[model samples]
Target: MRAIAYFKQNDIHFSSDLPEPRIGADDEVLIDVSWCGVCGTDLHEYLDGPIFMPKDGETNPLSGKQLPQPLGHEFSGVVAEVGPKVTKVKVGDHVVVEASLGCLDTHRWPKTRLSCTQDKPCGACRKGFTNCCEHNGFTGLGVVGGAFAEKVVAGERHCIKVSPDLPLDVAALVEPLSVSWHALRSAGFQKGMTACILGAGPIGLTTIAALKGAGAKKIVVSELAQIRRDFAQSIGAEVFDPTAHGTNAAEVLKKMSGDDDGFDFAFDCSGVKATFDMGLAFTTFHGVCVNVAIWGHKPVDYYPMLVTCKEKILTGSIGYTTLDFESVVNALQNGDIPLDDCKKLISGKYTLEDGWEKGFMQLMHHKDKCIKILLTPNNHGELKSAK
Candidate 1:
């Protein structure tokens, strides 16, 4: 089986003859991947090396898997085979795999308490939100193999059935959209409130769609990139180009709405320090500010005083839980969010054979022009150009 593997930190070495994934247990299902979305975390690993991923000699205590793991996770595919115990889904069913592996610690909630390797019952799992389980480990980020290849083996608990009406190519977007669902849920967005989203990247754009579906009174998107700004506008968001305006972003939003009254809620998806600050600066007093971005380095001036003074609720949201996935899938089915436009977020595409330096490098260097770039694997010795 052909797949993209990380031979070392920051190096993407493709192997055309990698061994195909095999089912390790009766609860697992083997999937033939149709499309996999290239995530920003993947690009970060390509340039900055492994940070979120497990290091050498480190293992996921639950799955007992080692490091230098497989890459792609945002994926959609069909059931190639299923273990005898996997009776919920049948062979040849189209499905999207939840790439997350949780800690299974419901009481530990969001923290990864399972790092201690204890035998405690997770609190989050006890509440039926096992996706945030601190006792279990992530599948794609922690496991050795993920959906980056021709075939991937995921536990049956992670598989979600998709209607045939959803195109296979577009189904790969469900995972990322699920993240947007989780963000809104964590922020507690309401129908009559206004929201200002920082950074109009893929996640930010998806959040706009989610907010619209949830009936947000007004949705404003701040983006420096013109292309992304245009896309946000096309999707009914009041788009603002911070760079072009030359005014303070927070001030601009207040002025446009005719008051110093800040935004009801602000979300940061860019992970940049500037955006995080903007999210805080623009939020209305007693409002909520959610940091949806994943960061490596600590940014300067995180404004603890402002949060205290304004009595604002500041929080951070990680990946999606199972409920988030259900919400996203339902929104897609109801046409609350346009799946057709979600496919347009694909800024670039590559085959697995494109190699690391070329395929992954294109994503890293071309941020302005790229949104969600994907790498398709040519299984069964089928090789074709991806121009």
Candidate 2:
């Protein structure tokens, strides 16, 4: 199996001879990966990490693993093998993986259906919020070998089948799309409501798609990058160039809304202090502001009076639930989301061998031009052009 593994901070290497994973339990499923999307988290680990890669001489408390781990979580594939007890999917089925690894003892399996027999459940899991389970661990980051290789072994509960007609490359986006879907659900989004997204990166773009699918009356996206702003507009979002607006982006959003009421929901996907403040300021009184980006360890400073004066609902969303994954799959399959436009998000593709230079570094340097870069174990070809 060929894989990209993290050995230390600022180091990830492609290994052609990595051992192939096997199904170790009755509930496990082995997938022959077709496409894996490189994520911001992977970039974070590559540039300044050991953040989720587990430090040297230490083990992840959830998975009992250490460094030299595979690096990909957003992926889709065909089922190559399934344990005897796995009934959710069969061999040759097209599927996407939900890589969040919740505590086995307290977390329920098949979260989409919410079936559980545990006498006591974790605080979050008990409330159907498994994404926030007290002992959450991401499979690709450390808990299990990821889809960076030819074969990935994951629990059946984490695998969701997609329409065979769905392009495998586009299917790889289910994981990230679910992240935005969960954020919308967390903010109590509803039809006819106005929302603003504070970034035009992958997550921000997906948030726009999700908001559109949810029938938001007005969708405003604020971004500094012209390429991203154009991409957002192509998908029917009214975009604002933050660089042009300077510190008045919030006021601009309010003016665009035609009333000073502000957006019903505002999302901060940029993970910066300034964007966070803008999201808060753009949200209407009594409306919700959802933090969808992971800030790592960086601290943010904001006026407490912002929340106090407006009676705003300030909340943060982590990973997505199984339902979110299922929702995205259905949206793609049923045409609620425009497939052609959604395909534009996949800006590049590379083989496992070229993932470091052409994939990760492309995002690291030319982020304005690259959106979601997919790395395949089998396809070593030219980069896919954006639609």
Candidate 3:
């Protein structure tokens, strides 16, 4: 199997000898890769990482898997094979993977060191918050070889079957969209609410589509990049550039909520000090502010009074669960989220053989001009028509 693999930090590349995955458990599923998306986290691993991929010599805590694994998590594919107990999907079904691995997943890898040394489910998982598991990991990051390869084996529980009517390329976007959907759900976002999303990057753009599907009354995307702002606008969001308003930017954006108070919800998709401050400052009394972005080790100064003064709620959302994937897929299929708008995020497509140079490298060097770039193994005959 050929795949873009992570050997160590800064050593990721395309390899033709990566071992092909197979269904190892009764609930396992083998998928023939159709399309996979290059994610920001993948770039982070190639640059400053070992963040999610285990360190140079360390193994993943949950799966006990080491580095040199394939690098991709956001993906869609056709089922190739399934374990006897895998009833959720069958061969030929098109699906998108949920991708998270946690304490609950230890049973699937019964021979793992953790399974033998520490088998208890994490407190978060016991409480039904598997996303916050103490040893949370993802399939592509380290739990197993990922979708960057020609084939991937995911647990049936992690695979969400989608309508065959949905293009596999568009189905690949569901993983990122599920992240935002989980964030909004965590924040208690409601239909007809005015929301402000900070940033228009890949995750930010998906946040807009999630909001659209969830029925936001007014979506205001604040971004510094003109092109990203335009991308948000094209997805039916009202775009805002805070640089023009100086210190009063938050107040100005609040007025756009139409309440003259503040946005009912504020999402910080760009994990920067500016957006952090703006998310807290621009939300209404009793409003919710959700942090969906992954921040670096550096900490930002916090003022409890900001939220205390107005009774505003501040929370953070991490990875998604199966529910988010199911919801996003249903939204895309039911006409709540326009397929064309979802397709708009795809700026480029490349074969897996050239994905490292043409897909990942393109985003690394010229990211501002790109939104989402997808890679394919070219296994599906539909590629001729799908392309």
Candidate 4:
């Protein structure tokens, strides 16, 4: 098995002789990975890692994994083998992994759901919010082996069957799109409402598409990159260059909203100080502002008076739930999310050998030119589109 592993901060390697994983439990499924998307967390692990990767001397209590763990969470594959008790999917099913690892053993009854059933489950899990389970860790990130390899094994609860007609590469996006879906649902988004997305990165772009599919009446996106702005526009979103938008990007959003009003819901997917402030400022009074990005210890300073005056609701969304994943898959299958537009987000492709230089580095330094890069293990040296 050839897989990418994280050894330390700024250290990741692709090994051709890595040991192959096998199905060890009756509820496990082994997948032949078709495509894996390089995510921001993967980049963070490469540049300033050990953030999520367990310390060299410590172990992840849930997965019991130490350093040098396999690294990839957003992926899709074919079920190469299935444990005898795995009844939700067969050996030849095409599926996208949910990736979020919760109390796998306790949440085994309903294969389609990922909830804890312990007498005293975590507070979040008790509320049916498994994504916030106290012991949660991503499968490829720090729990079980990841999908960056040719094959990886995961519990059947973490695998969601998708339509075989869906392209495998596009199927890799189900996890991230589910993130956006959960964020909107958390913010109480309703049909015919307006939204303002404060970024044009991969997640932000996906948020726009998800909003459209959910029946949003107006979608406004603020981005500094011209290419991303163009991409947002191509998807029927009104985009503005944040850097050139007057003194503050919020002003642009307010004007766009008309009558000096603000949007019904605003999302901060940039994880930056400016974008966070803009999302708060541009949200209508009594509206909701959702933080959908991972901010690594970045302190933000803003007027608390603003929140108090508007009676605004400030909330944050982490991972996705089973319902969120199913909704995105349904949207993709129903043609609500256009395949051609979704394919535009994929900027490049690479093999596991060149994933470091071509995939991670491309996103790190050339973010203006790259959106989402896919990597494959069996398809060595193949750089064509995953579509």
Among the numbered candidates, top TM-score falls to 3
For the record, the alpha-carbon RMSD of candidate 1 to the native fold, in angstroms, is 4.2
Candidate 2 C-alpha lDDT tens digits along 163-213:
889999989999998999999987799999998899999999999888887
Q: Give per-residue CA lDDT, model 1, range 49-148, as digits (tens).
A: 6655666666555565555556788988889999888887888898887777654322222233244322444677667666566654555565547767
Predicted candidate 3 versus true structure: per-residue lDDT over 1-387, tens digit per residue: 899889987899898998888777789999998899999999988888888888888887777677789989999999999999988999999999999988777767754666422256768888778898777889899879888989999988889999999999999999999999999988788999989999999988899999999999999999999988988999899999989998889889988999978889988999999999999988989989899988878999989999999999989999999999999999999989899998888887788887888888888998998888888887553332111
TM-score (all chains, Cα) for each model: 0.87, 0.91, 0.96, 0.91
Model 2: residues with Cα > 4 Å off, grouped in runs: 105-121, 246-248, 296-305, 380-387
Q: Select the stronger candidate by lDDT from 1 and 2.
A: 2
Q: How does candidate 1 score on lDDT?
A: 0.73
Q: What is the Å distance of residue 145 in model 1 from its true position?
A: 0.6
- Judged by lDDT against the true structure, how good is candidate 2? 0.84
Instruction: Point out the worst 10-residue segment of candidate 1 by lDDT.
Output: 104-113
Q: Provide the RMSD of all predictions against the true structure, rounded to 1 decimal.
A: 4.2, 3.9, 2.2, 3.6
> Using lDDT as the measure, which candidate wins?
3
Total clashing pairs in model 3: 0
> lDDT of each structure?
0.73, 0.84, 0.88, 0.82
